[model samples]
Target: MLTNTVTMTTVEIAELTGKAHKNVLADARKVIEMIGGLKSQPSSLGYSEATYTNKQNKEHPMLVLDKHLTFTLITGYDTGLRHNVVGRWIELEQVANPAFAAQAITETLNELQARVNAMAPAYDEHVRKGRTVGYSWREACRLADIDHPDKLLAVLVSLGRARKTTQGHTQLHPDYERDGFIKTLKPSNLVVSKNGGHLFKITSKGLTEWLKAKAEEMNTAVAFAGVDRWGRPIK
Candidate 1:
């Protein structure tokens, strides 16, 4: 359900958020690698131990602030975590009288939408008989309680979501990436693509088969991805 929609360029976030470029860069370092639109911190956390390196990178020095911000973003998306205390800090950030800081939580929710858009699901085999592809990996992992790399594949394979891991090939059985969907290239799998990007969808056969498999294991719940027989989630 979380998605990242309103993406700002790093420069744009710095200007709109009323933060120094260096400060923004420091705050958004880890996330920059993950998504396209980036936001900068509105202001400094003013920690005494925070140091600014004059090096070309010019990283943020305040570990406390850095930790706080990173955790804020992570916990926001992490559904498994029990605590929702990030709500309190985000509330506090709203009152700090900065440009984008006031909209921190809302902006994050928008980012979640954008991220979900980026995820753009495709059908894969659900290991069930008579089914093609149906469920997205995000829903599967959560339902199966198999977030670990080995276990994820195990469930996927058991549900016919994937084939046997090829020890010889790397991309076919890659390490777990905590970003979006698990990609597939089996001819029978779903096929997805954007207006002007590489191919990124699976086959209808893959979707049906996979959904049948998934239903056998997890019959009652609905996938938030909400993909239907036509292989599209309800927008």
Candidate 2:
């Protein structure tokens, strides 16, 4: 499995190599000492002391090593054991990269196109003739293939189209509103006072012109953002 940490513990190394944790710890210490004591040339040794809790809830000292130190420490091991460690290291490194994740999201979305089409019937015609209108915010999001309002807000923000307030209501950017892509709704009893009693919705032009472009853009943005450390991608 992929791990966020760049370093590996001697306990995990022992598991991978089918050795005792105590033995792995001894080997790690020897490598650390050969390079220099932990206090000297620490960077080259790439090790740090940590602790692990046992079944009895007692903490015991352990060593964590970065990739360089890990491989150096394992150099004396047989070929199969070294391969196991190398395989696990590759898995950990992949956690930091998002190219594969983006590709996966793209493929998933493509596979769901048929279902999206069935749910959003006539959406294309409405956009093509420039007559799209009368959709509530939720309906608009559904037609755009965005799974949630929050996800839609993320896509809009990435496209420089909208923003959300600290109070958690999303509002279109002034430039977009002025361009006739979106309009503010009159305050109603259902509107919350915290948002100044106003709600925003896409205009006819927005549904036809703006949303058409944004739907595709949302695909790319969702794929990239899905793997971003900040948020998950829109399904």
Cα deviation of 201 in candidate 2 (Å)?
A: 86
Compute the lDDT of residue 43 as modeled in candidate 2. 54
Give a tens-digit lDDT track for model 1, residues 1-235.
2222222233333444455656655545433322222224433431113444445876544333333344433332323220232333344444543444545677765564454334322111222211344334434433333334344444445555445434322122232221223344443332322211212222223233332234434433334224567867766
lDDT of 1: 0.36
Worst 10 residues of 1 by lDDT: 193-202
- Candidates' C-alpha lDDT: 0.36, 0.64
Candidate 2 per-residue lDDT over residues 1-235, each given as its tens digit? 3335578999899999999999999888855643444454565558888999978999988898997788776665665676677667655665654443646545544443333334333434544333433455665555555555566667777777776566556677787678787666544535435433325766656654566446656666666766747665445
Off by over 4 Å in 1: 1-30, 34-72, 75-84, 87-184, 188-235
Name the weakest run of 10 consecutive residues (lDDT summed) in model 2. 112-121
Candidate 2 off by > 4 Å: 1-5, 40-44, 100-235
Model 1, residue 67: displacement in angstroms? 14
